[model samples]
Target: MKTAVILLPGLNRDRDMIAAITHISGEPPVTVWQTDTTIPDVDLIIVPGGFSYGDYLRCGAIAARMPFMKALKEKAAQGVKVIGVCNGFQILLEAGLLPGALMRNASLKFVCREVELEVSNASTAFTSGYSQGQIIRCPVAHHDGNYFVDDATLKTLQDDNRIAFRYANGTNPNGSIDNIAGILNAEGNVLGMMPHPENLIEHAHGGVDGRALFESALGLVAA
Candidate 1:
């Protein structure tokens, strides 16, 4: 699939994301700057993990208002797939592309390590490579990664099969409401997650579970 990575100031994991997508899809992803108001036509857009804008006001608060954020919303309306990892997920919430918020870790510490996720709804475009109830390990590096949503919203997500991934038993790195590690927007075209799937695409990273996501996107675009 044709992919582009959003490059924001203080974005830390841009190179890692670029490398992983290049390796998984066998195509290099272009990096688009935050200041840009327009994005190229592509099958997918990725907002990778990083401390955008130095995490001054919450995690992704500053970067969320950039012009590209608006462009992304437009692309989503056009049915272009969008994936946000870690801080990118926070931005999606701030931009109102997704519901809920990412709160600070319950421990209030920067959690950086590999975590296991139980695939909740594998039927979506992003998880077609995974199986329902499959557990995949991916690294997460962030300070504010706890996912939160009200009871009604949470129930709506559950009833709609929108929860993408949940932390494996006892693997909830942060105190996310319902241990939600990832979720899909109402249309299922947009995905926001805290874990860094791109980090797990390389064999050297100890697993290839993340490849399923990239492969799924490619397959979806091909379809």
Candidate 2:
């Protein structure tokens, strides 16, 4: 399957994400610069992790206004699959492609380490490779990873099965409500998560838990 990986200024993990896609799916994702006006022809799009715009106003606030994002929003509306990681997740929230906002960590510090994530909604294309309640290890590196949404919106997400991943084993690294680590949109085609699945794509990185995320996307395209 063809995938397009978008990179914004200050983006640091584009290569890591591209390697994960190439290794797991045997396809090298096309790297699109943030200034590009057109979204490439691909089955999937990934906004990789990084300190976009040096995290100036906010983590992803500036990057969200890039020309590429406008096209991304249009593709997303057409049901194309999109995955946003770390700062990418923040961009999604800034662009209104996903609900909720990522705030400064409750501890007010940058957190970088492996985290356990529980699969809450395996029915979505992003997490379908894992069974419900399955725990997977992925690395999270961010300062503003605290996810926040109003009670009413949180209730709506829960009702719609949009809460896809949560901190597992009762550990809330960033103090997100209900330990939410990731979520999907109502349509289940878009996913945004704080954890860096691309970092765990190889055993050399400590585990292969992230391989399934890319593999799952391949399965979705194949089906």
Candidate 3:
């Protein structure tokens, strides 16, 4: 399976994301620039964490308006599996690929720590390797992670079983509504999450809980 990661100007975690994906998938993913007019057609595309364009004018705002969005949106509409982590999640919301917004943390500070996330819906392509209700450790490093959606929209997300992960242990690090850590789009081909699963895919990182995400995506395409 082919995977690609987009690199945006001023993004700090592109290299880290590259290393993690290489380690987990045994192949380095292709890197594309945010300014590009087109993105490569790949089985999986990841928009990794870190401040894009220094997060100027709101998180993910500048990068969202880049010329590449049209092609990226087209592929997503065609059922390409796309996953966004941290700032990437913010971009997806800003680009209108996903609903809702990520607001500042209730604590109003950048939080960096390993947080527990329960796999709320293991049926999607992104979480198929995870068991339902399984708690996994993943690193969350972000200043804006409080997910916000209207009550009616939240209920629709719940009714459709689109909630992918929720903070475990009653630990609401960002005060996200319903403690949601991740969600899937209506078509289930896209996933957006605050925690960086790519951060914990290596043995030296103190856990391999994130490997399942890569495995599930690759396996599905292989099948």
Candidate 4:
């Protein structure tokens, strides 16, 4: 499957995401710039983590208004798979692609460490590689990663089984609601999460637990 990576100024993890996709898929992903209004035909699009525009206005607030996001929204409407990590997750919420918002870390400080994540919903296209309730290690680095949603929305997420990954093993770095580390859109084509899966997709990163996500999204498996 063809994949594309969205590039924006100040997004430091774009290369990491590109490398992970290449290493796992055996092909380099195409990169799309923030100013570009058109994107190439691809099965998946990834918005990597970083402080775009110096995280001004709020995490991902400035970057979310870019022209590229309009194209992204259009693609999502077509049912193309999209994943946004860290600040990217914030952007997804700002762009209205996903529900809820990311707030300042409950500790009010930046957090960078490995945390365990539970596969809360393994039936989705992005998570079929793992079994439900499986635990995996993933790295997270962010300041405003806390996730919050109203009771009604939270109930809907629970009812629809859209919560993808939750912080497990008592490691709620950002103090996100329900320990939510990642979530899927109502249709299951879009995903937004704070953890950095790209950083842990290889053995050199200490484990290959994160590879299944890409494999699943790329249809390398029966996902």
Candidate 5:
């Protein structure tokens, strides 16, 4: 399956994401610059993690206005699959493709370490390879990964099974409400998470738990 990865000006993880994709799918994902106004036809699109526009104004705020994001928004409306990791998740929130905002760590510090994430919803294309409530190890490195939303919206997300992942073992490193580590759109076509699955694709890096995410997407595209 063809996959496209959007690269923002300050993106740092595009190549890592590409490596993970190629490792699993045996094909290099196309890299699309943020300034590009068009998106190529692909089964999946990934907004890789990075400090887009140097995190000016706010994380992902500036990059959200890029031309390519407009095209991404349009594609999302047509049911195309999209995944956003770390800063990419922040961009998705800024772009209004997903709800809630990422705020500074509750402790007001940057956090970098392996974090345990519980798969809360495995029915989505992104998490289908994992079992619900299964715990996976992944790396999270961010100063503003705390996710916040109004209580009502949180309730809606909980009721609809949109809360796809949460910090496992009561480890809320960034003070995210209810330990939320990731979420999926109501339609389950878009997924945004704070952890870096790409960083965990190789056992040499730590573990291979992240391979499930890519495999799940490949399954969707193949289907």
Candidate 6:
């Protein structure tokens, strides 16, 4: 499957994301710059983590307004799969491509560590490689990973099984609402998550627990 990675100033994780995708799919992804007004045809588009625009305006607030994001929104509307990790997740929410918002960590500090995540909804293209309720290890590094949503929207997400990954095993690093580590859009083609799955997809990262996500997104296995 062809993939693309979004690049912006201050984003430091694009290389890791590109490496993961290339290693898993045996193909390097096209890199899209923030100033670019269009994105090429691709099966998956990833917004990797880092402090975009130096996180000057509430994490991804500034990056969300970039020209590239407009193209991303259009691709999302067309059902192209999109995954945004860490700051990228914040950008997606800021761009209105996904629901809810991510706020500062409950402890009001930066957090970096491994956390367990449960596969809350394994039916989506992003989670089909795992079984519902299955737990996996992933790394997270962010200062504003706390996720929140209103009661009504939370209920809707629950009803629709859109919650993809939840912090499991008492490892709620940022105190996100309902332990939400990841979620899917209404169409299930877009995913926004705080954890850095790209950092954990290889054995050199100590484990390959995060490989299934890319595998699923690329349709490498039968769902």
TM-score of each: 0.97, 0.97, 0.96, 0.98, 0.97, 0.99
Better of 1 and 4 by TM-score: 4
lDDT of 6: 0.94
Between candidates 4 and 5, the one scoring higher on TM-score is 4
Question: What does the lDDT come to for candidate 3?
Answer: 0.88
Model 5 residue 220 lDDT score: 38
Q: State how far residue 103 of model 2 sits from its true place (Å).
A: 0.3
Error of 5 at 66 (Å): 0.5
Give the per-residue lDDT of model 2 (tens digit) for 1-223: 7999998889898899989888888878898889999988888999999999999998899999989998999899998999999999999999999999999999998999888999998888887788888999988899999999999999999899899899998667899997999999888889999999999878799898887787887684243
lDDT tens readout by residue for model 6, 1-223 = 8999999999999999999999999999999999999999999999999999999968899999999988999999999999999999999999998899999999999999999999999999999999989999999999999999999999998999999999999999998999999999999999999999898887789999899999999999674
User: What does the lDDT read for residue 220 in candidate 6?
Assistant: 96
Error of 6 at 192 (Å): 0.4
Q: Cα lDDT for residue 95, model 2? A: 94
CA lDDT, every model vs. true structure: 0.90, 0.90, 0.88, 0.94, 0.91, 0.94
- For candidate 6, the per-residue lDDT at 182 reads 97
Off by over 4 Å in 1: 220-223
Over 4 Å off, model 5: 220-223
Q: Candidate 5 — which pairs collide?
A: none
Rank order by lDDT, top first? 6, 4, 5, 1, 2, 3
Which is the better candidate, 5 or 6, if ranked by lDDT? Answer: 6
